[model samples]
Target: MKKSYCPIDTFINVIKGKRKSTIILHLFQGNKRYNELVKLIPDISERMMSKQLKELETDNLINREVFPEVPPRVEYSLTDLGKEIHPYLKGMFKGGIIFENKIDSEEN
Candidate 1:
């Protein structure tokens, strides 16, 4: 990840991608196989999911483990850094709800 003048920028840069934060939040629940993630985030295309996973792995926020079997099985789990960031993400989630509610009220 590139250094930013503000730490928030760095944080945003790491998590910025289509459904990247969502992917992290899901993996925070437990280790998941690729297909499981695909199912959990049906809105995201398989190709985009793959790309986000690769980027997350590269950022050291998540671990990708591949088992050697007839057909390779891969699972994703949050790394220490990923786990550490959960509180911040949780805050964001709560803040988002507040904003969403405001928007809904305005639309009515």
Candidate 2:
């Protein structure tokens, strides 16, 4: 991530990819496998999901563990930094809901 004078910009830059925040929030629940993430976030294409996961891992926001078997199994979980950011993300989630409601009311 690029250095920024504004801390918020740094935060945004780290989580600034398609469904990146969504992936972090889901992983906050618990560890998830690749297929489970796909199911959880059906709107994201498999290619995009892979890209986002790699980026998150690079940013140290999530952990990717691979288990060897007949077929390799990969799981994702939040790292300490990822967990630390959850409250901020939840605040943003709440703020989004408030804005959505305001928009709906304005349209009505």
True-vs-predicted CA distance for residue 53, candidate 2, Å: 0.3
> Candidate 2 — worst ten consecutive residues by lDDT sum?
1-10
Model 1, range 5-107, lDDT digits (tens) per residue?
Answer: 9999999999999988888899899999999999999999999999999999999999999999979999999999999998898888899999999999999
Tell me the lDDT of candidate 1. 0.93
Candidate 2: give its CA RMSD in angstroms.
0.7
lDDT of each candidate versus the true structure: 0.93, 0.95
Question: Where does candidate 1 have its weakest 10-residue lDDT segment?
Answer: 19-28
Q: What TM-score, over all chains together, does every model reach?
A: 0.97, 0.97
Estimate the TM-score for candidate 1.
0.97
lDDT by residue for model 2 (9-71), tens: 999999988999999999999999999999999999999999999999999999999998868
Q: Model 2, which residues run further than 4 Å from truth? A: none
